[model samples]
Target: MTTAPTPVPTPAATELSGGAGASGTATPVPRRRTVKLRGGSWLATVPLFAFFAISFGLPAIAIAIGAFTLSSDAETGAGTFTTQNVTDSVQGAYWTSLLSSVKLSALTALIGTVLGLPIAQAVVTSRFRAVREAVLSASGVLANFGGLPLAFAFVATLGNAGEITKLFHLTDHGWSLYSFTGLTIVYLYFLVPLMVLSITPALDGLRVQWREAAHNNRATTLQYWRHVALPILFPSLLGGYVLLFGSAFAAYATAAAMVGATVPLISRSIADALSGNVLVGQGNLALALSLDMIVVAVVVMAVYLPLQRRSARWLS
Candidate 1:
């Protein structure tokens, strides 16, 4: 009489049987759980959104609105909408200063682009990894190591009383810190590092095969740069230009310290307006100027959008 074989337990039921005795206890499987998001992520994001809006966006909006409004009368709490501020900004002191600022930014961008290319090329094409690492590290440090401290460093190095200046007896030929040339020099100190960082990737994007092919074709140095390197690196160069333009445009501290005189650069102008006496309605102009900055920032961002799109397309 062949009795039916004992039924084999299913995988779900079978456990503790690899080496343990039959009397050994089997472990129960943990129940699986399904978690569903309540679609509250958007709601959860409200606080952060509100915080930025109140802190940054709202203030910007208020400044813009103030830019378009006349100062409120201290006694009567009366004010009117006017175009004078905008007109003044366009036609008065702001226009010339704005032009100067634009010119300075353009010059700085050009210089940075021209100088940064070789440095970036060197950093990218170097066979020695240590050299590349050193350049990258130094670029990072120098890029962020500017402001008042940088100005002082320059002074200590090149000032009439400076060690190097004195060592060279440069006192016979004094350095002019208050000139456009001086501003440009200080700006280059900040600008070159930015260019190096910005263009390094573009320089790297130039494949060795392209250079080898160019050489095989008997391409001259200028020909290689014109035909092969420039097209590949154009996007990075444009990006570098934009970066340098924005940096020089919005620069405040270095220019301020170097100038030592109240030059009407946009940033200094804005600073003056903002730092006006609080005892009077001077704060209103400051708010107006802040809005002006917001407007300028918006325009700069607008310029950036097309370049970014082009870079994306090229990369893709």
Candidate 2:
């Protein structure tokens, strides 16, 4: 036989040697190299990161620290850690203001959801592109149309000497611009449009195929909505409600300008505390109130995120 029989390579040997041929000389495999970011690449984000740190992060840190600390004396400028500010924030008039804020936020969120859902649905299902565009454009503008200008606009329309008040003789009918009812009306001006903008996408995500499938399966319109549509829409509806609640709860300038501290809102209370109108040496108490609002807002967002995630599962 002269030459030795050529050895057969095993599959494992071939794989390990990078599929080397029968010659037995192994081929080198090239390793994947990770691409690292260049110094210039990171520079682009520095400005944005710095802006957030200065504007939001620093202020938030100050509020958190100040909430739990009290000055020993104005002259000494020494702060000692304490929870009395938190305690005081939840008692007496502060408690009442907190309750009023909760009630107002809840009421406005409910009303906005109820009124806006139908409008969102109508706009989403509309055949005309112009109609949808107009509605959406209007909603976008109105949703952001709040603060002092919004308050002033409502005042010009519903105040004591307002045109509607004079025309309908509302003052004689016992309507007051500075009352809770009036505040609710003013809130609705923005709340309804916000809800519309929020829920429109959710409504648009409802596929026509779902309704067709339901109809094909001999399902009634009510049954399809009750079983399929509602379940899918529930998460979105709840998310929108929580978002609206947080927004209304944190509102300051509109309520402050419209009704002053007459409505006893948490925002107004915080303002009073900071300005020394409510009590002297109560700046820490204002920070505590702010912390409470932050906590409530955090809770609302926590609830909203999960609901939004669940809704996205179906819609996506």
Candidate 3:
């Protein structure tokens, strides 16, 4: 008698259905798992978002709300909303203080931009990697090495009784480290380094091919810079200027430690208002001053962001 032959199963069929075991019992087939990718929608960012909301969003909103609200007794919290505080902030002494901060910030920002651009260019063009590394390292350090320590260092190095002051007889020459000029000079110590750090990438973005092409056109160095480099670099330059301006405008500790109330900075004025050094129950005024600062900061960011995006296209 002819026995019925069992047909061999194909690999696909064996995989889909279970394969036979050595004992001739069919094995269980493995199921396929579908993976879901967790993009930004995951809960991992919740903590960070919550922290930011608490730390910055809350405080900024409070400041904005408080700016329009009048101050009441210490226990009563805020009073009715009014524009008095806002108006007061832009008038008289507060106005002067704001203008003073702007002048100082602009002066230092321009000076830092001018001084730093060449230094950045030199570093980018340098053949020695060590030179570039050292310069960039120094810049990073100096840019961050500000506030009280920087103030004290400048005082000890250039103050009335300082070693350099005595060596150069600067006091006799009326070079007061407690004045506007001295404050500016001290600001430059950090500002220039900041400029170098900010503009180095933009300078590096200046391709060698641009220079070669300029040379091919028989352009001189000055002509190349005027026609090719400066035009391209202008946005980055303006962006750096705005950056330096913001840095100087917001600086408080250094100016306070060095020049005190003589400079009339907006930050100092705001501090004075908060501390009741000017008047009691002036928290409303402090809030207003803070609001003014916020406005200025908003304007700076508005200008900076666009320029930064534009520069990135050419430089990046």
Candidate 4:
């Protein structure tokens, strides 16, 4: 039997192993020193960190400080501090406005979640790519389409004397577009689309193999979703709800333009306070109101971050 030729070591392997040289002795070869990156790659994020400090951190600090400072002190740089502004913020008309904003945000978020989830699922499951593309594209546009133009469009189409109302006798049935319910409807216009964009990726992340396994186990469609899909998607759904809540909570221009003082949203109150509509020095009250808003947002973020981490862990 012919013996197999001895395997030859590659040049790289020879160098690494200190292979025999012409002297018939092992010659040690120095291993190349790898340039260890000492966290310099993190320097790339400096600009982003600086931007947040300037735009977000600094402003947030200013808001916290201004919330405690008296209006007179604010003007004179005295830095005199008190809790009266914060206390006053949650009382009387300010309290009423804060409650109203919370109610509106909760209502819109609930309705948006319920409606948007199915629409997003349908788009993701559909075989018609063109239709899905069209819907997603429209959703992207409508999610950002708000403020003055949206208010104008809705007013022109659904307001009491608007042509659609005139055509359908909507006002005859008490379908006024200037009321709280009307505002909810208008807010849902953008919020539902925003939900679509937010949750579609999560729905898509549902692996086909999951469904196949469920089917193999004789799980009904509802059973599969209940036992498999919904649980996995719960975190993402909650995150979307929180996002929608914040969007509605912080909305200013649309409510300001459409409903004016009638809605009693906190954002409207902020505008009134800041513009000296309440009183010249009530700008301090605006800062207090802003502090209340910041607290609510912080709480919402606290809830959202935990859910987000859970979602990433399970989905990935």
For this target, which candidate reaches the highest TM-score against the unseen true structure? 4
lDDT of 1 by residue, 1-316 (tens): 8899899766544644433347775555567998978877788999999999999987777777777778768688567887666666655666667777778888988998999889988888789999999988888888787779988887788765778877888768766555777678778887898899988876765667788999999998899999877875676687788888988887888877767544567677666656652234544555555556566666876776677676655544
Model 4 weakest 10-residue run by lDDT: 71-80
Q: On residues 161-254, what C-alpha lDDT tens digit does candidate 4 reach at each position?
A: 7889999999889898888999999999999999999999999889999999999999999999999999999999999999899999999889
- Candidate 2, position 140, lDDT: 90
Write model 3 residue lDDT over 1-316, tens digit each, in one string.
9999998888987776678766878898778998877775768889999999999899899898888998675786849889999999999999999999989999999999999999999999899999999999999999988899999998898998888999999988889999889999999999999999998988878999999999999999999999999988988999989989999999999999989998889999989999999798888889899999989988887887887777777877
Q: Which ten residues in a row have the lowest lDDT in candidate 3?
A: 13-22
Model 4 segments more than 4 A misplaced? 1-29, 73-79
Q: Is 1 or 2 the stronger prediction by lDDT? A: 2
Count of clashes, each model: 0, 0, 0, 0
Better model by TM-score: candidate 1 vs candidate 3: 3
Q: In model 2, where do residues sit more than 4 Å from their true spots?
A: 1-53
Q: For each candidate, what TM-score against the reference?
A: 0.75, 0.84, 0.84, 0.91
Which order, best to worst by lDDT? 4, 2, 3, 1
Candidate numbers, best TM-score first, in rank order: 4, 3, 2, 1
Show the colliding residue pairs in model 4. Answer: none
Give stretches of model 1 more than 4 Å off. 1-56, 75-78, 169-174, 277-280, 291-301
How many pairs in model 1 have backbone atoms within 3 A of each other, for residues 3 or more apart or on separate chains, i.e. clashes? 0
Alpha carbon deviation, residue 144, candidate 3 (Å): 1.2
